[model samples]
Target: MKNSKGGIYKRFVKRPMDFILSLIAIIVLSPIFLIVALLVRTKLGSPVLFKQKRPGLNEEIFMMYKFRTMTDERDENGNLLPDSVRLTRFGKLLRSTSLDELPELLNIIKGDMSIVGPRPQLVRDMVFMNQKQRERHTVLPGLTGWAQVNGRNCVTWEEKLSYDIKYLSNITFLEDWKIIFMTVAKVFKRDGISTEGMDTAEDFGDYLLRIGQIDNRTYIKGLEKSKKIAN
Candidate 1:
């Protein structure tokens, strides 16, 4: 297949699919939403939604929502505990079942996300994507994408970026639906929920030790690529 030069038609078709599918999901999944919200409120207390700032397309920051899957348990010094410690059995169920991600339907409706695209990352991770990886943001971030259904958080950052770039080059209506179908299967099987040797996917800071940060050389290289795309 020829590499897609992303354009208005691509974005236009993708957005409507996102909006319609997200709206249907929100409505169809309302029962599960209520159940999770109740469980989270009872088990986790106070705020039911976990809101975090994640970078979307072009490294833009947006608040992403998920069902709160961890507790705010603090230690003697009043500092928060690690994710492993804070993650409870109930939380594990949510994470493994991916029920925690339902609230992101709103993000799709609000235009912060798509049903299929590169998964959004945190500001810290985006900063590390430096210039090269930042190009992944040329399209809306998604609930699921090439990087996600392929290996998800299980893959190394470099591997994930390679998939992201490939998706950028080949995006099409047909390709998006293919990714969506793959995502459904991955979710049902709960594949790649955790990276090897980590409780959850380790933070970017942790991954950097193994893969190295996007240094100045890579940034300049990425800049050239981004310029080529822009032109």
Candidate 2:
């Protein structure tokens, strides 16, 4: 009827719903959470949780948490190895099974996220978004979302952002529950865990540069903004 964001469910119901569901999930899944934490520590070492600053609602920066999925192994030069190098079999298992994202329930409980919305991206990734694409940040980020269910790491950056924008326009209560169900199916299927031949999805700026959709100077400027936000 209006900008769709004015919908009653989004304005009044979503956050409380997220809070209740996430709290229940944390309680019911406590055993799984503890086991995952211990396994991450035993496999990836200390700091069993992986935390990073992500752009959330209204582009606010908040630390998002996940279980550690990679090692801190550095090289002779004292620089960390590549993700492909540091990510082990166990890490791959966690990623593929989506077990590494368990800690994000805390983010939902803290109201830093929703159970459904655009999945938050790294600040570096957010910097590369144009004004229109950035509208995805108008709502709290989510653990799983339309883009996530549709193609996950399988889709192109453009496609995923399009899905995020599309989701904002369709934020009904039924729509969110539908997405949640679809997400469960996708996770169990472990579909689109990563694009073929890639350890992780390509970063937005890198994708833009590779496809010549953005100039080197523009990407460099985005990098400057990303660095500024991270600090």
Candidate 3:
């Protein structure tokens, strides 16, 4: 039997609430958005917004947006430089303050995301997800989520996925609000902005391979499949 509380909120209330709250946030935070956009343009050059396809509900693909935080520098071979090299001090400030994620308000308004749920991950990373971990996609992705508030980029992939699954199993107004408050606290404290020595969380595929959870052949196959889907 379904929990009436969870079913009612999930099926009827959540989406409408997300839409209204996101709309209100975008309006209320418009000034902050403008300031951040200006900074990104001046500091990072043209194309102030960074866009990438990520896995959303049921692993569906959608373009996720963020303030541009890196440069377009490349190497002698014309290959793009590493994240640490491209990320500027200004970009770090935006990330630490969580201002870079403001543009996701548009995604929420478009119904491509929720304000609270598992944060959408890279489409390529989805190939590394186990069946259970894949359950994180049962609902719309979020700008801030259970795992994000708990540890953000500081936690291991396993721990992060577990937090996401826990959130999925327990959906309610109170839980959602709690996560939101926690996210705000975390941002203010600037806790877990990134793992030590990493500009962002390590790629899921690399983690799986490092831990011997997936053989080289499997990893290669997953990468190829992910690229095909991405393209």
Candidate 4:
């Protein structure tokens, strides 16, 4: 909290650095973006961009964007299929290579996100966070954060949140660049793209309920809140 070296960098340097880096990244990656968009359109069919509402700094709602990775397949009742069912080989490739996350560079440019910080979570999942966990929102969410560079979808929600808090407590330019380089290495290795036997991470609310952090009533309430937001 005090204006230590890390705090000074966060307060004065982080945003401008994020802006410049993200702008340059978007420019450099524009061709990849176009190719991915075309591939998504051809494979997934329409809505090439996956847009979702996520909580940003101070829990403000903002639209997060990614290249669409799943199909619009539905069940007999017309409900959408599960991610495991809809995610194709190409989609999995996109995720494993971190290409799907490219669109978030725009979020960084828009000030809705940072180049490095805590990764954003669903607005619906906010109810599961304790006051300490909620501290992650004190700064902008990121395209890749400490948690992501560490274990990403392989780690438990609690572990990921701990990493996020650790990053927040010691925000420094050197730390961020370290995380960025680590993220690139992890991407190349394709590590922790998803936990074993799962295509995506489990919901935070379900994790909280399983860990007895939140009661059944609270979980239901969170689901209801999520539905209302969707509507």
Best by lDDT: 2
Instruction: State in Å the error of residue 73, model 1.
Output: 0.7
**Predicted candidate 2 versus true structure: per-residue lDDT over 28-116, tens digit per residue:** 99999989989988988999999999999898889999999999999999999999999999999999999999899999999899999
Q: How many backbone clashes does candidate 4 have?
A: 0
Model 2 root-mean-square deviation: 2.0
Cα lDDT tens digits for candidate 4, 67-183: 999999999999999989999999999999999999999999999999999999887777678888898888899999999988999998889999999988778889899999999
Q: What is the C-alpha lDDT of each candidate?
A: 0.81, 0.91, 0.90, 0.89
Give candidate 3 misplaced runs (Cα > 4 Å): 1-6
Give a tens-digit lDDT track for model 1, residues 1-231: 222357664756778878988999999999999989999999999699999887776656788999999999999999999998999999989998889999999999999998888888765555456566677888788898999988998888889988987888777888888998998899899999988777777656446645656455665554464444433
Best by TM-score: 2
Clashes of each: 0, 0, 0, 0
TM-score attained by model 4: 0.94
Model 4: CA > 4 A from native: 1-6, 211-213, 228-231
Report lDDT (Cα) of residue 213, candidate 3.
Answer: 94
TM-score of each: 0.87, 0.96, 0.95, 0.94
By TM-score, rank the candidates, best first: 2, 3, 4, 1
